[model samples]
Target: MLRYIAFTVFLLVTGAAGADRLETSAGSVAVTQVVGGLDTPWAIGLLPGGAFLVSERDGNLLYVADGTVNRVKGAPKVSAAGQGGLLDVTVARDFTRSREIFLTFSKKQKGGAGTAVAVVRLSENGKRLTNLRVIFEVTPGGSGGRHFGSRVVEALDGTLFVTIGDRGDRPAAQDLQNHMGTVIRINRDGTIPGDNPFVRDQAARPEIWSYGHRNPQGAGLDSQGRLWVSEHGARGGDEVNLVHAGANYGWPVISYGTHYSGQKIGEGTSKPGMEQPEHYWDPSIAPSGLLVYSGKLWPQWKGDLFVGSLKFNYIARLAGTPLREVEQIKGPETERVRDIVEAADGSIWFISVGQGAVYRMTPDT
Candidate 1:
């Protein structure tokens, strides 16, 4: 019994249960597709009550509980064109007591759409949201579908973290005065945090946390209170970066990848001032949502990072210090994964971008 127990412990430590995984260099088996009958699902906010709140790109918020999905009405009218639609949804940490929720989207505006992030108080039974207000908005307005600069996360200290896309205007990423291409730190109510790095830049927006990024679709905190961001590159060089406060991540410049027509992006890789990625993809996986595992369903997958690949149609189970890829949950061309959330019950929740379905990948056991 002692020998058997020792071997089990070893397996868990090495993360080698080898259950089923996306068919990649380190993984095997295809991801089982769950229910597939919704719109373009964007994000998943797992609630404290074990249910989930899902958002679609068409401005619809749905409540999913006990395996039933109910379309939530009264969502704000969003710009339903191109990349302008409802995006991420997240319930407040004290949602049970406060009944507040947070959302990020592309708000329709003159000429183009302005990126907006808001936190509102939800109804008692989660039917509708009241007191809706925009807490963050990208100024000078963006028109194209290039970048909305999204991803909202609240640290344990109650401060909120938000990412802004470069809005297809590369040079704006270097300008801390603009919200585009920045990670902003704000209070839970959409006010600026006093300790923010750019709070004193005088010329810079006070919300700026880090600047110079393309589109950081995925941003989350690790166990040690560090921030992890996954962003799409121009041609190659999709990157997973460790974000630091008030730092600069060179965008359109110093990228490992060049332009679509083989033009050099910037001053080439490795500049003096720009931060580098912990890991990057050469072919561009079009990475979107991200999550750090704190689950037990796949006992071996604890303490790792999982990202949903939109272009690759796979879920990358990355490992290592900053997480290199050890496995992938490719669905065999079944779905475009937008977000991956490890549920409170240890199940994997995959949100499909095109299919608009909420799939829960559970252990076959």
Candidate 2:
């Protein structure tokens, strides 16, 4: 069932005016609702003319403009079961001319359900979608409902990166023969990129870019165009990794965290060939969304990373040479932050699943 909280009570908890002014490490900022009355909003995308697209976990797409929210048609059918549904939406780089957008969802397949990516043209009026086409779908769809790591990101090089979880099949993460627990790199048309790390490996899936992830729900590109992912750990080892081509991120093998039952995880925390996380959380915050700030509005935040915590009801700000959590941005408005993105004007936008709303954060004068 979807979690619901009284918005009025939330506002009262913060302050008057339905906006919260919170002091952060950088400075005081105002958190205001952009839109509300949503149902389990999973991801958000910025559209031209200042409109927005918000995807709900139950297969509803919302178009919010001028304070009015409308349902958008033409989203693909989703499984909507156990952490699965319409997940992420991304606007095309040339959206002004292309009117195109990309979406990632848990598709119902022959075996059960798996993550899939589809592209569609938003109608000029923004009331519906057009020319919808499935670009890619996970092969060997699994039966379970948990751990569909389905965050889609457009790389600086124009290729697409889709994050997939272990699908609750731990051992599958270490096998390159399947798509589980891996990052996939593909062209816009859903074709495998020739330069993908495993494209030439006969025993590996050509689309595999990196492997051994747990449940990477958050992905973003930093200023230098490098991909970074924030993933859930078994019990307490949530991690933020600087993803590299063909790198093995020790999942069921090594971890700073152990099983929920306090049992030791595989072979300790370091293995010979497995990569270490840039940062990790021992107590586990259940991280969901990621953003690498450009600092257009706050210069001090440039090169810093922002992550949403589903379990903690806060946004984590991390920085420094070795990388660490420098601050926590939290309030009643930050409940279950599912996705975080930077607006074109450099303001921050995020989804609050607990409150069922979209919020924007801007520096206070």
lDDT of 2 by residue, 52-167 (tens): 99999999887877655667888899999999999999998888999999999999999889999998999887889999999888888989789999999999888999999999
Q: How much is 106 displaced in model 1, in angstroms? A: 0.6
Q: Residues 37-109, candidate 1, lDDT per residue (tens digit)?
A: 5567788888876667888787888775554455665677788777768888877788888887889898877
Off by over 4 Å in 2: 1-18
Worst 10 residues of 2 by lDDT: 1-10
Q: Which segments of candidate 1 are over 4 A away from where they belong? A: 1-35, 332-334
Q: List lDDT for all candidates, in order.
A: 0.77, 0.91
Flag clash pairs in model 2. Answer: none
lDDT of 2: 0.91
Question: So what's the TM-score on candidate 2?
Answer: 0.95
